[model samples]
Target: MNPTLHSWLERRRDWLGLAVLCAVIFVVMPLAFDVFRLNLIGKYLSYAFVAVGLVLCWGYGGILSLGQGVFFGLGGYCMAMFLKLEASDPVSTKIQSTPGIPDFMDWNQLTALPLFWEPFRHFGFAVVAVVLVPTLLALLIGIAMFKRRVGDVYFSIVTQAIAAILSILIIGQQGWTGGVNGITDLKTLLGWDIRTDSAKLILYFVTAGLLVGCIVLGRFILRSKLGRLLMAMRDKEERVRFSGYDVASFKVFVFCVAAAMSAIGGAMFTLQVGFMSPSFVGIVPSIEMVIYAAVGGRLSLLGAVYGTLLVNFGKTYFSESFPQLWLFLMGGLFIAVVMYFPNGLAGLYDSHGRKWIARLLQGRRAAAKPAPGAAAQG
Candidate 1:
């Protein structure tokens, strides 16, 4: 162990300050904004979920995935189906609602509810499907691609195409999936009135809980043996393979974890916003997730949390002021970050940088001082 390096690393900063800041925000922000602000922040936390997974794949695994939005929406739609099924009033209020079916199914001229939709009637099953489906897909994709050594630009293109296709398919399935209009006007979730403030708070708490748990979980994973193996693979895959490790299996495991995280984010999003649309799950949104991860500081998990908040805040501010140009503005922001900060925000506080800076300063001071032997002899 290098004493100089250890000293610098230990002197820099502890997680204590960050921990206190989190406590303060969670406690103080709710008081300032009533239920509306709290709920909105909760929705933002779901975006943090996407950032977390991006940090894992892009940050540690060196895999650039631009289709997290597809997984997110998959989970969302699954949860939406259950909520819609449990929603007696939404079904009844629908102009075309029949004796036992929801409005959309009847309006689409469907004689009976699809058997696929039957499992969603049970919230537990829907929740499990929401998580597992995306995970399994990620597993299969990661196994095939990693085993074949297809990565970098090719991988990005394939994943981006996946997101685009999923969005288009959802929009085209008007009869079964509600198409472009999306599943909206939701009324209740698990017998709780969706419109009530209490329900909103519950959803908000759920999102907060998930975000905290994920942060802890991500940090734990990064510190564990598996996390070390992932970093090694990212830095040099062929070397790791020669060292007797199964590279494909490691990649697939991380990929599945990332997909499940994105799905959880999506499910929480549906619960909060009361809607799920094709537009939200498109290629653009997936790229935006990558941008958020990059901007937030990929190396540090906490970077994702703040990156989502900052980017979303920018979107809200710019969209309100320049509705027609917000997309361009966002693109510009992304370009600016990539051009200026290659490693993203996390690079700013990296251990190596901090240690180097300290070393440079110490060297300059030492060079300026008189020699110890000369002074003693004098």
Candidate 2:
């Protein structure tokens, strides 16, 4: 085949993979599952947003951040704050001493809303903050770390420390962050009750749509000149730096993009799950998010989504069936993936599945062709 044609075919295959994933999320899953299960999948998909970000930051840019949960939590909290305020209207909270303040704030003897929380009263601000807050924080971290040439395991450790610190701060500030419980009682968005079944169904599609958008955006990045530069920097950072390129800037940009993506996921999670907590903004969940990327083939964006769904499904099934062994089971699964399938599911497909698909297509083409010399006989 001509090189140009082969490249075009490869591009089509990539798009085809995305189309299949869309079908699973939008068409098949909705048709196959009930509302409750669909909502659960929505929650899983929210986590997938983080996994997708990891593919770019870790898989492509070679930036392994173990504190993505902090960004996720920040985005979740930003949205949760807005929702909590909406639900804290005077009529609803009339029983509390401070009817206009959140219930937790009232319980903590706060007579007025904090200055920081006041801005969240507007839904638009919360939406903007969801993406902006995390990205800005990532920018700061990136500049401080990348400019100093801190990376590899050191960067990962620093991210984990940040996650731990953020978790403690949120839990310590009960009045402001809902304390250990994080943020809860998120009931509505712009007076629309999010608790209803119909609302959940809609939210699931919204999450799915946003997830697809993120994947598309990620694919665009990976196809651009910057994408090639990221891979170059990842593999040969010193060489790229010496070649007149600003290596630190590229790293900072990708890290911030990953942060923004994770934040979007966090915001969606708050909307779909109806709560946000310190548990999600900590070390454990951050590590698990990385595992999702690893299991899905960090090099493959769509694989990240599938990896998250498969792992979470296993978690749910095992926890319900053999609660005592679920942790071990999950651990074993991760170990197996790392040991036997280092490239993850996407790697498996590339090695074997793609070959089988190609053969099948070839066979069909051969069968479609007319017998040799048949036209001459006619």
Measured by lDDT, the strongest candidate is 2
- Pairs that clash in candidate 2: none
lDDT of 2 by residue, 122-158 (tens): 9999999999999999999999999999999999999
Instruction: Give Cα-based local distance difference scores for all models.
Output: 0.82, 0.94
Question: In candidate 2, how many Å is residue 197 off?
Answer: 1.3
Model 1's C-alpha root-mean-square deviation from the true structure amounts to 5.6
Q: How badly does each model clash, as a count of residue pairs?
A: 0, 0
Q: Write the per-residue lDDT of candidate 1 for residues 1-378, one digit (tens) a residue.
A: 357755755654336435743774477776777998678778888988989988888899888898999899898898888887777444464565454666676778886778888888897899899899899989888987988989889999989988988999998877677789788777787777877899988888778778778777887788799899889998998999999998888888888888999999999999999988888789988988888898988876877777787788788878989999998997788788788777676665563655676677678868999999999999
What is candidate 1's CA lDDT for residue 368? 94
